[model samples]
Target: MEKCNCRSILCTQMTSSGPHILPAVSSNSDSNLQKRYRCSLVEVIDVGVRYPPEWRKTLIMLLYAVLSTLLSSLVVVLVNNWVPAQEIVSPLPDLFPRSFGSSAWAFQLSEFCSFLLLTLWLIQWFLLRYKSIVGRRFFFILGTLHLYRTLTTYVTVLPVPSQYIICENKVSGGWEVILKQTFKLMSNGGFFLRRSPTFCGDYMYSGQAATLILTYMFIKTYSPDIFWVYQLFCWLLSVTGVVSIMFTHTHYTLDVIAAYFVTTRIFWWYHTLTNNQDIVVWKGICHGQETGNDAHG
Candidate 1:
């Protein structure tokens, strides 16, 4: 319960008289100088994140990621074939149909933003992994969120209207497809070869919105150094992405709204649960270690 006043850069020093940020250094320090990246919010919830040697947590995260990916893909395949509520066209026509036409520009913008954020995330993750800055553990928690998002997509089968459904023309017949189909087959009782192409009718939740928001959530939670820059950009991306979903008629209005709520709950609950219960991350803990000056910008 005591405030951490130590100058060790690995720890967060948030309290009265401290600078607006964690690992706060004097303004005199050169702008190019790398300060340690420590987030106070994550600290309170998960201790294991502060240590890189916690391979157990990383492994568990990987397992979860694999399962989530398979399940999510299966859901995509299945939902594409399932029928949407025919009577329910223009779910929230007032809030949605924001864009004039299916320019595909909005959707493309959202996809590009997600891709850009993903690339940055990968770079940061690589840096953390290289520095042993609990990168894998961070990735694991992130994977958990996606997994939850994926599994929950099937909770309801509300489909997008025929007019709004954008065909995901990309045909992926690779190792991933094989794996997802295998799980799909197993999860069901040997139902194979769904004839309908897996693109339309995939509604009830917007994966695009979830990806952008979750990406923002992770960066906001884990990386505090670029708080202002990243947070603003991420929020913008989230808004644009949600709006794009509506504009492109790619998803029903509730799908995008539900995604935001679901992703927020998943992120909040996971961190809170870990923080509240030491026993949960017991095996994931590693000895307290000091982080070096090499931090992300």
Candidate 2:
């Protein structure tokens, strides 16, 4: 009888405490859910909170761009020196006549449009609340485009389309010549301050057309909600730059055609691959939580 009485008392105690225990667990779960919801909101509103600058990757891309540009310029110089001007064959029966009205102003106009696109992208980054992530992507794409240009130009040598175009003279020394030519082109500041040195045999694809088109692609993909008028202006600028490049006769028709094809293809391919990544993992949304777990593990 004493044992039975003990069993009854223990059962009563457990039944009484059940309500309190259950409520504690239920409240804790609700609190966790609320915290997670607020975190999601912050991620969406603050891009920097979700995406760090990733300076290492940016630096790598910048270095790649510089190297590829130098390599392309080096190839131009070597080709110019190695082949006699008369021996270099122009692509025969050129599309729309090789005698296009070449003008210095046309080249300058194309460069001016490219410069404007660059300025607008910067303004968007600094003043208009665009993320640097987009800018990083732009530079990366540009570097890739230039790398492709380097390979193409190296493989196939095309004569300068216009006789009026001045090719840089052969010079002694290897690295020194590359550096000098690259410096001269860079110092020209996209033909803003001075005429860009005409590098012969860079005719498989048009870099100006590629850059202008790339700018348009970035603006269209990232900032579709931006002012419609500004968007229209960008479209107009790209068209004008492309047409202007053609009139200069620095490149054959195939060069511009290949540029459009290659640039757009690479851009779309890059985004399509990257966008498939898991959003939370790719952006490091749980980095702090992971660190805390490791510390307290």
Candidate 3:
């Protein structure tokens, strides 16, 4: 058979509708067959679908995430000033003994788990071919969650949830102190030296739990090559982090529960709306149009 002298190579990918021929990106050779085989391996054996990455969308979503997080940190700093640090009576913490000496390490353990999840997410961003799309979805969800949190945390500030959890002492300085504290929270989830929390009273929901759950959900949804055992392990790690937050007395039980509900619901809702072409809100971002697949990121 005579080879077609087309500028772009075409590969077949199976989507929900049916098999569709889409352009495959290859730097090694101009051979269409070779490109097809590589794309087939990625779509068929790994991800079960071809999702062309959009670098623009990913970067935009990342910007949204950064802005939202920065806003959240700002709120934390301001709220920390208005609300004095005082432990409230909560059922979960009340049931257990308040031993600062013993449970000090649990906060460190939670931070470690969260850091590991973040590292894994970065590795995935490098490894996956359709990473831009995955990143877009992840960041959009993250930004939305954090943005909502800014409202929830600020509207009605509650007293500190745990006796052992240390809040930053209110200082006599001006905006410089607030700026320093905000940056501190943004840099390391408010943990200084992984020993004590820097800011307080921004806790209507647990950010740590939301982050861990989001990482797990994204890994499970996007990466099919990962074994079931590894997925289970990831889930177990998330559970450990969430449980550790309780032990360390960083967030109330209600905060963690709200995080789980709000995070999962928002994640699913956004994906569902995007997946259905009928939803006009996400039509700009969704990949239902054939024109999007032509430009691979």
Backbone collision count in every prediction? Answer: 0, 0, 0
Q: Put down candidate 3 lDDT per residue, 1-297, tens digits, no spaces.
A: 223234444556566797787665445556655533324334224557666667888899999999999999889888877776464333245333355323767878988888887787788667978778878888999999989999999997877766666777775588897778777777875432363545778788888889989999987887676478777878888899888887776677778889999999999998887787667745665654545676753
Cα lDDT for residue 25, candidate 1: 46
For residues 12-49, write the lDDT of model 1, one tens digit per residue: 54456773454544446554443333333333345464
C-alpha root-mean-square deviation, candidate 2: 11.2
Shift in Å, residue 21, candidate 1: 36
Better of 1 and 3 by lDDT: 3
Off by over 4 Å in 2: 1-49, 86-91, 98-104, 128-130, 190-197, 278-297
Kindly provide the TM-score of model 3 when superposed on the true structure, using C-alpha atoms: 0.70
lDDT of 2 by residue, 230-250 (tens): 888888999898888888777
TM-score of each: 0.58, 0.70, 0.70
Ranking by lDDT: 3, 2, 1
- Looking at model 1, the pairs that clash are none
How displaced is residue 281 in candidate 2, in Å?
A: 11
RMSD of model 1 against the true structure: 15.8
What is the C-alpha local distance difference test score of candidate 1? Answer: 0.58
